[model samples]
Target: MIRFAVVDDHMIVHDGLQAMASRADDLEFVGAAETPDDALALLEETRPDVLVLDLRLNGESSTELCATVRRRHPDVIVLVFSAYGNTELLTQAIRAGAAGYVLKDTNTGRMPEILRELVRAGSYFDPRIAGSLLLTSISNPSEPVSFSERELAIIRLIARGANNHDIGEALNVSPHTVKFHVSTMFKRHGVHRRAELVRLAMDLQLLD
Candidate 1:
């Protein structure tokens, strides 16, 4: 079973998610919490495979919580399930190590399937927020950036949702090489996260 935990301040959301997970034969509703501290404790106790987290937990920054969880328990994947559609917050969450970002307004019926895909694929993003991310990247009027053909190839792989390991295998390079290139790309684009890099590449039409 794909064991999961929920960290949302709303009891209603928690109950709804719990009920949804309980109905899915492949999913296990591990536990729920209303604050970052409580979520950390619950995660420590349950050691769930995935964490369904809210962007705001009792008015605290859930992005930081995601970073902390990732630092403390790298095995537990974090999926940001929030009502807010702020692209800045989404970017921060991605940078903080959330593997997925799904808006709560999305059909709750699809959450289990999304969570399953996230656990299987290692990354996911809500369609509703994707356009905004692209727009955000495009709106940033930085000096024009250029990339080499190989860098463009890697960016295309990233745009297609390939992780560093997958990119390394596809390019017949070591993961370290892929990391080096990605880091170089990040510095060139003045971005710090994979999601941002992909979005910027899309904005530049580099993936075309």
Candidate 2:
């Protein structure tokens, strides 16, 4: 069995990934964490074969944590399971030594194959991610995500049940900025309510 651990701030995200990972025979959900510190502690003791991680973890830097995991436990493969899909952070993650970057928006059904491929093929990146290192010179499978990186970040927080004020505090930005992003996102979706934003995110696979 390929030992696996998933880390994210929300319990729902953790439970969802776990459920998806459970369907495969080779993958085992050995551990989970709600914060970076919790994940690091689990990593030190368990020595899992792979880690499914999130980008935002209650004020901690998931990118830095990925680097540390690579440096400290060279054997554990890190696969980022985040909502943020930006070129810079993705590039930084590969440099930090992550095995792959799979957006939470992608079909959760494919994750088992991805985990297996990471261990067998040494690395993997989501085909649906633009500028993904895993893709070749020919065709790009990902639709060009139009929103700016900051907008993407706020969208994720909103999907995770965070209100405007909560999102602003989490991102260390002003509530006005959060409202701006939220409104822009809604307008882009041609939506007039928060519920519609959630619906669009789900329908478009913008969030898992």
Candidate 3:
């Protein structure tokens, strides 16, 4: 069984999800929490294979919470559930190391399959959100956003608003090389300016 811990404020959502997991032969509804603090405490005590996290829990900031969980328990995989499926929020969660995101309309029937895939393979994508992600990819096919591993590292630094000279010093490369990488990133991301590329990289979760 794929052990799971749920973090959601709504009792109904919690109960319903528990019931659904109980009905699945391969899923174990190990525990549930209504807040980030409680969830953290629970996770420290019992390490679940998957954390079914509600993106908006009462008034808590789920993005920071997700990042914190990842830092504290790097082994626990997080599957975020959101009511809005906001692109910014989804991207932010992914950048913080969430393994998946599912909108509230996600099909319950496929929940078991998704959990299985996550447990066995360490990944899962909610179909509805996958469609949105695919649309983004297709629409931006010519966006000039391809990044090599080295370029990706540079972009992450750029995302921190690092100056070319500072970035070069930190990365142990010449300033000219950093400038070239930045210029290439701008060209590939289809942006005319450095700030735009920074925003785009963050949006694409190419930089945290």
- TM-score of every prediction relative to native: 0.66, 0.63, 0.64
Candidate 3 lDDT for residue 166 = 83
What is residue 97's positional error in candidate 2, in angstroms?
1.5
What lDDT does each candidate get? Answer: 0.83, 0.75, 0.76
Q: Which stretches of candidate 2 lie over 4 Å from their true place?
A: 130-208
For candidate 3, the per-residue lDDT at 59 reads 48
lDDT of 3 by residue, 104-207 (tens): 77777778887788778887766655666567668876554346777777777766878888888888999999988878765444456766555555545566
Q: Which of the numbered candidates is closest to the native, going by highest lDDT? A: 1
Show pairs that collide, candidate 3. 144-188, 144-189, 145-188
lDDT of 2 by residue, 1-208 (tens): 8999988888988787789777887888887998777888999888899998886577444778888889889999999876655444566577778988888877778788888998999887776554443442235445453556687677778778898899999999999988988888765444567755554454344564
The parts of candidate 1 lying over 4 Å away from their true place are 138-208
Which pairs of residues have clashing backbones in candidate 1?
Answer: none
Models sorted by TM-score, best on top = 1, 3, 2
Model 3 lDDT vs. the true structure?
0.76
Q: Candidate 3: where are CA atoms >4 Å away?
A: 137-208
lDDT of 1 at 165: 93
Residue 48 in candidate 2 has what lDDT? 95
